[model samples]
Target: MAVKGHGMEVKDHGMEVKGHGMEVKGHDMEVKGHGLEEKGHGLEEKGHGMAVKGHGMAVKGHGMEVKGHGMEVKGHGMEVKGHDMEVKGHGLEAKGHGMAVNGHDMEVKGHGMEVKGNGMAVKGHDMEVKGHGMEVNGHGMEVKGHDMEVKGHDMVVKGHGMAIQCHGMEVKGHGMEIKGHGMKVKGHDMEVKGHDMKVKGHGMKVKGHDMELKGQWYGGKRSWYGGTMSWYGGKRSRYGGIVFLNW
Candidate 1:
């Protein structure tokens, strides 16, 4: 699953796990924080806001929103849109941070294009992602800071927005290929196309299959890991290929 900056923790998943599902922590998640922490499968935060969708989906945060069957939400201004959706946030809709969807197929337009599907495409500020397989594109792209390391293989990054095409996922960064259990991360923005990818970061998008996305005006020195690079705060590690991605 895709995991954004200080996004969802494994436990924070609202949906109950059943089979092969890796029990992704940050599927369809959004977060903004300074310091980060992950406990069990939950991301307890002290940031702007955090959201997680699951079985009996419910979320809490400033302008937080969750949508699904039997989805009931509670917050100062929260919203959950679906057939059997319920909410308690009085100003949720007014804030425009709220979300709406039917049967999981989502396509939000205008304000901030936040679309959801097997081939998810989002055009907005955070560019968040959710589910097992998805993609996100935004303006805050890439991880650029001191101590950021990406080793081994081809780490080529050249483009504006990060995109992931199904089957043959072609990234714009240095003509990289993450097809077979490979992970591609350029600074903060990344595109994971393989079945099993492992990259780490601090909060924003969450797509299944071990992909993480984090967003911020300024990149922070944090450490976290999955299969390849782990995310940390001013932390360092040794890998294979060392490439530089500047956005």
Candidate 2:
């Protein structure tokens, strides 16, 4: 039996540690560890329930469990969970159930996926994609997919009922119904509505009516109602018979 502390070093028979290093061989296994240097934190346990913590976390055999607050790992068995994820792979096995991803930059391997995008690379299983700049490869696609690399973005993806207005647009479809403004759509079932258009800063404000032009966008001297206007050289003002053109 032997014990040592404070920048510890221990050697008996089945256990050996140098500085803050650790080793537990077999027979009535016991270990307590801490490290900052001296092999810069190393851990080793031959068998039976093992526990490891921080700065290069390592665990071997006997129903392994690992938790990391920051990098470095070596494992014979695996289970992982991440937030603000970054990876280095070894024997990777993945399963995502009812997957929903919002605001995406994707590289996916599929099962059941629901995606909302920004620069995409997808592999399909049960795929549903909502758009902005896309590159897709298909499997069992239930696609509401769009890619012409949208600039000045305004997007709407609806599987049932929808209403839309724009600045820069990208839309993907399922069962789409849109009340318009310079309409562009991908595909499914479509409907669009637009009447009289004017846009400079673009305005639509109506509450209890005083100058009713209820669509969307308002600021400084009224110019909104209905939808559809892309700007350049603006003039056509009388509140609700809107038309302004540029290019």
Candidate 3:
């Protein structure tokens, strides 16, 4: 048997099986929130699987995966909650952050892969694992924040998978890798190739700047690019202005 949830909620359940295979896939099952939550025993020879791939506020178990075969049993994301979440493959991949009123914020992510006669993989953003006599792989990524009352500017941010926030800016990228700026003010520009990067400032400023060039010169009076000269803050004061020269 196979079960999957695209846009719905499945809750509260018990199961018992012998000499058979069972599969659970997609959103909430056997629990209060979204996805499948397993409870009970006698699940011998039972195979179960679950996947949650959607853009919604399910509130629990964003992307969780579970698989079982033969007399073996495998479980992932027994408990989950948050938004923009994802759990993929036979292993669990919990990614994203939880909310907090006046305390610390929590975030987690997990990724794994395995292959063998009897292998298992469980991954989560804020993840935990337990298995035996099988090949198991697990990975987690998390970020926690403290209170802002004492520090005056306290902020907590977490992401189980990959989290990006643009308070007042723009970003562009493709696939898992990203290239762009988190925040840009005026005339400054930047480019990068990686998984994550953040920028914050105002007026012609590049927060995370990376430049590669050959044959650059800085003159005493002003900056010159071959024969053309330009000042960063305008051509008014020579001593208190910044300049850039390209060749």
Candidate 4:
């Protein structure tokens, strides 16, 4: 004998098995009771409480609440939140455990964010903290026609583990600025400045219209004021090139 009731409450009388396929196989049963509250021993099963065997599809509410374990199989796109979230097989995979927020803009305002892989790449704007910043494994930050400022200890810009090479302008240390083509400096308390600067094998070279050094000038040839020619601190005749004097 089969008895079914809609919008009914059967309480305290003892054993209650709600749904079809209880005593008989190949039969469909559905219990749609709205706002039904079961307090003690809410749901239990001897084997597999909710099992969908042989190509069956089970979908819960739009905002379903599962208190315990949740599993998905052979699905294209599956999303899970809270605690253990696992995925098997590779090919365009995004898996996160211990609070993973996946969106267009994911903002994490907590502690510790880790990315474990051989090489991690970032295609957008990557900004670091004020005091500490780093790049590893033959990869450094590359900015095209933009300014980068690092205000901390030991600023190193190296190519093949050697300072700087092939640059328009390269500055180092405190108060020393460089601004032209082909320059190099490797000494304590050194200053090198140029226009259209390049720091290479040689040294400092100012390849521009005007070049000045410590109130002295060099355009065509080397000469001092009052018709005096000094080469390597040796005086000679300085009546050929133009010399400017400050009175």
Clashes of each: 56, 5, 25, 11
The per-model lDDT (C-alpha) reads: 0.24, 0.22, 0.19, 0.20
The lowest-lDDT stretch of 10 consecutive residues in candidate 4 is 112-121
Residue-level lDDT for 151 in candidate 1:
17
- TM-score top scorer: 1
Please write out the lDDT profile of model 1 over residues 1-247, one tens digit for every residue: 1111212111221211121111113333322222112233334333332323221112232222223221122321122332211222111111112121322212221111111111112111222223221121222111222111121221212242234322222344322234433334444434343443322333223244222233321233332222223221122322222422222
**Candidates arranged by lDDT, highest first:** 1, 2, 4, 3
- Please, what are the lDDT tens digits per residue for candidate 3 over residues 1-247? 1111211111222111111111222311111122222333111111122211220001123332221111111233222222212222322222232111112111111211111011111122221112211111121211112100001111111111122222111222210112132322111222222312222220011122211211211222323112233222234222223332110
**Candidate 3 at 190: error in angstroms?**
17
Query: Which residue ranges in model 4 land beyond 4 Å of their true spot?
Result: 1-130, 135-139, 142-166, 170-175, 182-188, 193-247
Tens-digit lDDT string for candidate 2 (69-131): 211122321222332211112122222211112121111111111112211111211112233
User: How many Å off is the CA of 15 in candidate 4?
Assistant: 76
Candidate 1: TM-score?
0.23
Better of 2 and 3 by TM-score: 3
What's every prediction's RMSD, in angstroms? 17.4, 25.3, 21.8, 33.0
Between candidates 1 and 3, which one is better according to lDDT?
Answer: 1
Report the candidate with higher lDDT, 2 versus 3: 2
